[model samples]
Target: MSLAQRWREARPPVAGVHLDSGACSRQSLAAIDAAVQHARHEGEVGAYVAAEAAAPALDAGRAAVGALTGLAGSDVVFTTGANHALDLLLTAWPGERTIACLPGEFGPNLAIMAGNGFAVRPLPVDDAGRLDVEGAARSLAADRPALVHLTPLASHRGLVQPLAAMSEVCADLDLPLVVDAAQALGHMDCATAPAAIFGASRKWIAGPRGVGFLAVRPDLAQRLQPRLPPPQWPTALSVLQRLEHGEANIAARLGFSVALGEHLAAGPALVRERLAEVGRMTRTAVADLPGWRVVEPVDEPSAITTLVPTGGADPETVRKRLIADHGIVTTYAGVERAPFEMTSPVLRVTPHVDATDEDVARFVDALAAVSA
Candidate 1:
């Protein structure tokens, strides 16, 4: 089937939810269809064929991600998803490598770093979700970390971190910086420094799921021997050898490549401008709600806007209400705080290029009804 036909068939029938590419226009669908055709002709039919032809798609996808981050194609590595890319990075750099990350980072990334046996350190952030740059610098210098993982924007709260300045710090310290751009890829301009950059196409890029890219500086890439050694080694090491192979998601890769082309054609500035407008409208409509708080900064980095209810209101309650009653879908950040500690639950509302003013207004109305 054509990509357009697939998209039309896959698109959920809903009005107010700000999830799933926010607003998929005709241009986007056409681009995806073209990519689908390209993938078919390229012999990307099944897993075995995909594995054999992985390098080309990997190369192409890397170039696209590099353009987004202002890096060279040689610096990029295509991965199955952001999580898998991160796992590869962490596994390759395991053992007492002091790693510093933002406290309010995306939960899964944090868990992966911890699970991989790195000594994880948290950088302090203000209530506004802005990282203390000086504090981060101090922590990095003191710890002399091998890797510094940061999210340009907090996914849960939609606050923009000072990436340019942070990149400068990493450069000065000669530390490798890995940015989780999963949520910021199309919405913001990422630092082009020789740091390792990771992002997924599923979020803002409006691509199929299970496709992401990782960019490691040429120098760093050379140093990274895969966590698993080569196959055909001794029997004792065969299980470990499998880790060396990088798996590619062929269909999703093609979809992501197509989505990226569409995004580039539209231009990042235009996408950001449209999303910002939707965000502003959403904020304005919900600003007067008595107990609801906008967690995103007044001038946040990207198109994601998060809201939280005061007085310990349950986030799931609001999320379920929005999905069930109004057909609006939103996300909540899960917490893992100690007992007796008060953790703020958050509801995320991400605006996509396809989203319209009507969609934003409907979401606002839904929030008002649920909060009331």
Candidate 2:
């Protein structure tokens, strides 16, 4: 069966609403199914698919990500996840290096750098969640950072960072800009400039879990060392290495290609426009709801929506209520802040290409009921 047909067959029946693509995208089920099928067929199933196939489905998946991200096929490397990609990328980063990130950047990245012994610095962001480019440049200059990390769209806040501008700053400083495009990939046009772009298949591209790619500029690839080398060191890099070498994701790669093909058949411009329309509708519906404020900008490139509840409602409490009482699924962002709790508690909602207008309405209505 075709990827879409496979998707239709495999997708689970779920209830009221869904809005947590940052954690995972329901859209990726088709690609995952395809990957699983191909993996099973090749006897390349399990973690060592990297070693079994000369050109594994996982490699194909990495290549597909490179195509989507505007990188050369050879520039892409597969990782366990976006977080694994981040850790691998920063593993060898020079010492005392300052990495600039948005205040509301994904929390795990900060923890990774801290654990790895890099100094982390927060850049200023406007209310809409765009990074202050000038400020970022100044910080980079002051710190003489060895590497700079950014999330094109802040997963927690649903904000789109100005990638081209940030790329320019990194270019000026001769620094490598590592973009966490986990949320931006499929939803936005990628920059063609040289940089390290990491993304997960589980989010916007709607692929499978345990799959992600890191695209390094062709020139940079030679300079960086592989975090995990294949068993046959000099002979050839494993499937992961071949992925780093630019092998395509056979099954999911085909599925991702199919997904992008569908997006193109629908027209990426049209897909983006539809997402924006749904986002606007969701924002409008939530505007009048009591004690709920939309934190992310309405015009951001991503389809994620972040809501902050007023009136002392705990985010976890509301999230559980939405799931249990209303059949609506959502995500909470305040779980990590223990010592000094973050004042702005956020709940995320994500809309996919497959999501319907009725889905949006049902989700909003669920939110209204939960808030009430």
Candidate 3:
């Protein structure tokens, strides 16, 4: 079967054309079943026993995450979600109270850095809001921030950052690079070995919510001293596991593992290629809409496409009407999503690999009808 066919068959029936995979993807049957089965097993044989029984699947999932990010299973740490993962990393950051990041970094991440007592500086970027590698390298060398953070794919725009180039720069400068791959893990290639990488299971991975992971370099892991919550354990775990809390939803981790397996079996390269094609198709199809302009280029590498509404059309109202009147789902990104760079609100359309030409047509027609 084609990849789309397999994906469609694996997922439950959708209420409408789902174009908001950037927020939360539709979960597959395998993932849902794994989570539900684990919950049931917990009821049958106590939660701790069930978790012990689930160790192998969980370990396999960790190893898969490590492989994706160019780390080992032992180096992967689980958390509530990407927010928690970042909190763990920033709390354990073994550096000074300053960091540099892209201007288009996610707004919540900025809040997290501030909450952790780190002063933020914007890295140099081109006019298009992408990392200017040479400029960024020069700025990093001159300023010498304690660390560098990158969001490879911004939530409000489709621009893909030059993570590999930045990684090389950090390696040369011996500056630690922390990556927020919440939107990049399944949608794009994430094997770049930075100092630390973190992401969630709910977005492109199509895994259950409430699961996130952090993979740290071995030497960096040793240096990070995560401020563990009250009631710490006496025995020792792996250095990475120290970041994870003792209590967790084991069932969700199993579901995440199943989703990771499903993504791997479908092949990451194939998935990324199909998503890029869908993105290009969506951008082309929506290019001529009245009073709305595509934010990204016709062939942006990522799957996300943002539209800036013109002529006094409120994107938030349009987003609501798309769901209420047309039964189409999408995201309305306000300046709050990327406060530093976004000048206006935008409509975000992010379809998954299972999206069809008909789906794109439906969205275009629905948008036209609602905006008029």
Candidate 4:
């Protein structure tokens, strides 16, 4: 049996063909059970004491994330999720308010920047929703903005941005790059840290919700003046400590550690390989669906495949029918949610590591029926 096949055996059983991995993955039973067990322990020992015992697991999780992102344990700080992590960074950041990001940047991220009083400038992208590297480079040469934020992969689309190429441009101009790898964290290679990298555990990590981390290049982290609620507890000795508030979620961290352990066991390279294969397979399977435009490029690499309906197929209605009638799951991406380059709604279809060729075929059949 394949690695993903074996991994599937250990996870909680799914109600149906689950293809919304881009939102949250069906977690492993061990991951869930570890959380439950930790909660029980907390009840017996009290939250503070239980947290002390969980320190090792917390450290393990940090190490796992660090290894995955090519950072040291000290460089990582846990947060509630990606949005909160971004808020933390923005709160601490004293850089110039003007920032440059791709046209297809995640809507929530854009909101965070705006709420924090940053002037967001949109960079150009190609037809496939990828960052135009040369264009962006040219713009950077002209503006030399205080920060350049990039989402390595789009939440609503299947395209992977040219992160490395953009990084090189930023590096040359001494421009600070902040990458939101919420979609790419566990599924992509993030070892080479730029200024900061932040993501959630729920998506590709297959970890529990309510948990995520922000990894900073240690040297760069020193520049941050982390925020603390008024009457701040003064024990925070480091950047992560200052950002993290009292009473860590011991159970969630334990669960996240188990999930991280599962990822480590499977090996990052192998997991990414399997995910990319399933991505291409699903894209090919639904390529022939009529009256639909494949928004994601055929050659662009990502586990997400978004299909935009045309000729009377309402994207929202299709999404409802996909789940209600077929027991298949998908996320409907409205233009408002994407807001930058998307003009029409799209359906995000994500195939997982264990998803087989048969799974994609069945999903496509049901999708076709719904669209018709």
Candidate 3 Cα deviation (angstroms), residue 298: 0.7
State residue 310's C-alpha deviation in candidate 4, in Å: 1.3
Assess the local accuracy of residue 145 in candidate 1 as a C-alpha lDDT between 0 and 100.
Answer: 71
TM-score of 4: 0.96
- Give the Cα error of residue 331 in candidate 1, in Å: 1.5
Against the true structure, what is each candidate's TM-score? 0.83, 0.82, 0.97, 0.96
- Report lDDT (CA) for all predictions: 0.68, 0.66, 0.90, 0.84
Q: In model 4, where do residues sit more than 4 Å from their true spots?
A: 229-236
Clashing residue pairs, backbone N/CA/C < 3 A, model 1: 23-354, 23-355
Q: Rank all candidate structures by their lDDT, best first, as comma-separated numbers.
A: 3, 4, 1, 2
Candidate 2, which segments miss by more than 4 Å at Cα?
1-15, 28-32, 42-60, 94-96, 127-129, 227-267, 335-342
- Tens-place lDDT per residue, model 4, 39-94, is 99889988888888888889999888888877787788889899998999988887
Tens digit per residue, CA lDDT, model 3, 63-92:
989878878888897888998889888888
Ranking by TM-score: 3, 4, 1, 2
Q: Pick the lDDT winner.
A: 3
Give the per-residue lDDT digits (tens) of candidate 2, residues 1-372: 433344334456544566666677674455556666666766755534633553554455555566666786667766656887778767744345577777766777778878878876677766555788998888778777667887777666666668888888889889878888877776766654547888777776666666676787866655555544543466555433643443335555445544544444445565566566656666766776787888755665567777888866777888999889877777888745211224566787776655666777787777777776
Tens digit per residue, CA lDDT, model 1, 195-269: 688878777777776667777776666556464653335445322123325455566677777777766766777
When superposed on Cα atoms, how far off is each prediction in RMSD? 5.2, 4.5, 1.4, 1.7
How far out, in Å, is residue 58 in model 2? 5.0
